[model samples]
Target: MHGLAKNHLKKILSTCSANRDCEYYPCHYNNQSCLWCYCPFYPCEDEVLGEFVKRKDGTLIWSCMKCNWIHKPDIAAEILREITELTLDKTTECSIDYLENRELLMQIKNKIEKKLGKSNAI
Candidate 1:
């Protein structure tokens, strides 16, 4: 493939679709793909997408397996772009700070939207 085509292919490979034939697949409603099997912005405090559950052992678990926000194509692509900008390639740790401080997240979103020349539609 040409260099430009190869570049586009690389972008797609950044978060490809999950296997549809696998059992226990389509874990979320609407059959959203699990491209983000492990969310980078995990431990988030998005009450709409996740919640905290206390186990019998008195340990709190952040149950987010059912959240399909990251599985959406646009969201996944935007997240990958933000990660690239943040230079988080070699980072293994993520913070819940963005949850508490939404400014950071909003700044990134605004920048991305401006770059794409898109309005922040609801």
Candidate 2:
């Protein structure tokens, strides 16, 4: 938690809401958390979780539509917690950096891998 204010952490955590009314509700799973409508780790280019798809224009883009690792409520909460702990500045109450923190990114990848196991089940 570092020195992050309790209220601020709570505020961040509160954003992890499940919107069931949306047309694309349950986009990944029966009870997936809609915390990230768009993944924070887009273009990760991780073969285990995603891959490059060739579009009609022959442009390659990373596609993670089948990856549901982050949709799990617990996983989403943990990721949010880790990100806040790593990026939030206690004094300024601002997020100084996010993806630039290699350690944090690695931690997230390792957690995803551990959960996915050898099969990489969607």
Candidate 3:
């Protein structure tokens, strides 16, 4: 391939590259890792959902990028609904000190979206 063509290909590869957030040996950052290639949850490519996540029970759930239509393992999610129904008798103060992880999540979503667009899946 010509030098300019090679450079252009590299730009495309950056967004298409697969990465492993898990601490696995010999990650495929170079050319081996097969990360999230497409919207894994939604069935139809036209309505590609954002991604799939594993619940504490190891069940998979697909969440919409635009909406909150989480699906899959309907039975598993029922536990969550039940939990929400129950409440403590007494009021108690609670807080969550979580750092902003939106950027990281967005980066992964944008990369996946860009790759899907390149393949003309939309």
lDDT of 2 at 119: 37
Model 3 regions lying over 4 Å from their true place: 19-122
lDDT of 1 at 51: 91
Better of 1 and 3 by TM-score: 1
Record all residue pairs in model 2 with backbone atoms less than 3 Å apart, i.e. clashing: none
What are the clashing pairs of model 1? none
Q: Which of 2 and 3 is ahead in lDDT?
A: 2
RMSD of each: 7.1, 6.0, 16.9
lDDT of 1 by residue, 1-122 (tens): 99999998766554366546547566664445456667655666556667999999999989876566667667656766775666554444444433335666656645654655342121
- Consecutive 10-residue window with the lowest summed lDDT within model 1: 113-122
Task: Quote the positional error of residue 83 for candidate 1 in Å.
Answer: 1.3
RMSD of 1: 7.1
Off by over 4 Å in 1: 1-15, 88-122
**Model 3 residue 114 lDDT score:** 56
Please report the candidate that would top TM-score against the real structure. 2
Report the lDDT of model 3 for residue 24: 43
lDDT tens digits, residues 1-122, model 2?
65678777665554576667668877777777778777776666778767899999999989887777777777777777767676666433445344656666776757755764423353
